[model samples]
Target: MNRFALNHATTKFWDQREAVEACARIGAGIGLWREPVAAAGLAATAALVRDAGVAVTSLCRGGFFTGGDRAAIEDNRRAIEEAAVLGAPELVLVCGGLPDRDTGIDTARARVAEALAELAPYAGEAGVRLAIEPLHPMFASDRCVVSTLEQAVELAAPFPAETVGVVVDTYHVWWDPRVFDAIASAAGRISSFQVADWVTPLPAGVLTGRGQLGDGCVDFRRFKTAVDAAGYTGPIEVELFNDVLWSRPGPEVFAETVERFARHVA
Candidate 1:
């Protein structure tokens, strides 16, 4: 079997506790979200993971510091603590978009760097690495300004390699021609590898349009090989945000993801 994982967002309506239990049954790891973890109560969820013997591959998110807001930073701090308690080694960072008043992508990206410099040490102390995830350029204005792997790696450069790293999420990056080169150069700084496909005729607003594996144009096998060659020896997380997938049962989605990984990614 492949080193596959189900990022909780892929099965948005699934009960977090049941997801953990299902992962345990199949010896697959899981990527969790802070909201669910908090809703279930951190201590209780931590105990659930421990009892189930399911690995917490990585935490969903812990970044949004583009606006230099103290609240965002503080929220990330708590996310780090939660990851540590749950035995997750890294907290994925979805650096936020431009502030309503701001218009420059450069300035927004700089804010991300400043935030990382300030938080990296704290994360190191808390035993969690920050994984900077760059979203597609289409989301530059309202979701994330960091639009490529190169940019994400650059933002992570100043910090200690272990304390700050980049997440190579294929869905946001498959269109980049130099993607493999960037992946090769990331080397040890690659903290996470997530996979999802891109389909055309995007859903309204496009946020939840991610395609299931093998159902779109993404070259999953190619991405898998590139990350492996880049020395990423971690779980390959499936994180589709498709509404169609969410309409089905979580167990069914999980099984489909596994089969798709075997056929298209392994």
Candidate 2:
């Protein structure tokens, strides 16, 4: 059977302890998140997951290459350190949007390149791989400027295979016409594969209104087969950020997510 994992942000409504416990009880073996890990106290959360036999698939985010300032760079470097503390295998990088809040897409791309040059080496040394997560083009203004699998691969081209790679999330790049080609090109370099459905017309641009498994247009089985063909045998993590799921009890949401993941992708 295909393994199902949860992104911590999907269960942000719950405290870290509750979310971790719920995932453990429901047979979930992977987790992806950043802030909650800090708040949960790295050692405590690591021990909890360890006790429950859960796997920390990848951390939520570490890159925000815009701002063009020292502070932002330092913050991201700290994030890499935190990933080491928690025994996470990958640090998801949502490279920043336009620089200084006024730059264009070209400037954002340049900034990300510069930041990655500095950060990737450091992260690689710590035994942590950096997974560059391309945000949807809808987020090109305030979130990640790297908005496609091809773009992400290009950005990671200069780095060693172990130092940089891409996180292929369905919600972000499913609509791209070149998705199949990108996925094929991404063989052996896909650091993570996140699952989420893209719903239409979101009011707020950031915190997802992502659809549930089988509720939206993403063809998970097809994606799984492609990734498997690419030799990426990692966990296919379910990463939703829906208001409706957030309002429910943590355990209920976790169990439902696991069941739906099996029904749709298995």
Candidate 3:
């Protein structure tokens, strides 16, 4: 189905070209990362995807605005430009957690809002939406201070729906009891929808432990229904950070991801 997409991180070692080609063959969208894209040369990457007729669903990340400094804002601007070049409408933002030696989480989140205010207009002019992705609460201290969909929605409220949006990632928000309500409120601003399962007994590095669909506890169909009901009809990207999947051949992992998506999500 062309409605499905594969986020490049799920097959970490796969070269970006190969991954894009595979998704192209099936008419699937792709979620690309800034590093690999930069490594491959921006013009080349942009042409490759364009020639292949593949849609770039969204950019992996572009935020770490705890400082609200010029550097962070400039970098995020670059990311928005990159997404625009690749014809990606959404540039996902993983707002940074507490800055080093800084213990105030509230302040970190406030900086995110301030940073968005500075960058939203630039993003809108570039034809890209800044999608605020709220990570699970466990990441509140180090990775993302916006740890709930509600908070993300609130952060995005100030800007136009086209300029600022919120991402719905199952691995990050499935545990919250009010996720459905948040999704409903995100009616005009649901930028991207990502699917990943949650398995218990996290590995030593929990970041890489997101399970394959159907291999964990997430209710994929339920989320799908909720998102659809909320009026989101865009590509559903499968993003898994599992180490086991990354260790396999990219083609193999991609095939498995497609199959699982068919069974659990599609």
Q: What C-alpha lDDT do the candidate models reach, one value each?
A: 0.91, 0.82, 0.94
Task: Kindly report which residue stretches of model 3 are placed more than 4 angstroms away from their true locations once superposed.
Answer: none
Q: Cα deviation in Å at residue 87, candidate 2? A: 0.9
Candidate 3 — what's its lDDT? Answer: 0.94
Give residue 215's lDDT in candidate 2 (0 to 100). 87
**Please, what are the lDDT tens digits per residue for candidate 2 over residues 1-266?**
34677888777677777777776776665665666777768788788888877778888788777777788789888888877877778889888877664687788789889988888889898888888998899888777889999999998889987889899899898888998889888887898989998776674755668988888888888888888888898877888889888888877777778878889886
Which portions of model 2 show Cα errors greater than 4 Å? none
TM-score of 1: 0.98
* Candidate 3 pairs with clashing backbones: none
> Each candidate's TM vs. the true structure?
0.98, 0.94, 0.98
> How many Å off is the CA of 248 in candidate 2?
1.3
Residues 1-266, candidate 3: write the lDDT tens digits: 56899999999899999999999999999999999999999899999999999999999889999976789999998999999998899999999988877558878888999999999999999999999999999888788999999999999998999999999999999999999999999998999999999998899858999999999999989998999998999999999999889989999999999999999998
Candidate 1, residues 28-114: lDDT per residue as tens digits?
Answer: 899999999999999999999999988899998888888888998899889999999999998999899988774587888888998
Model 3 Cα shift for residue 140 (angstroms): 0.6
Model 1: lDDT to the true structure: 0.91
Worst 10 residues of 3 by lDDT: 100-109
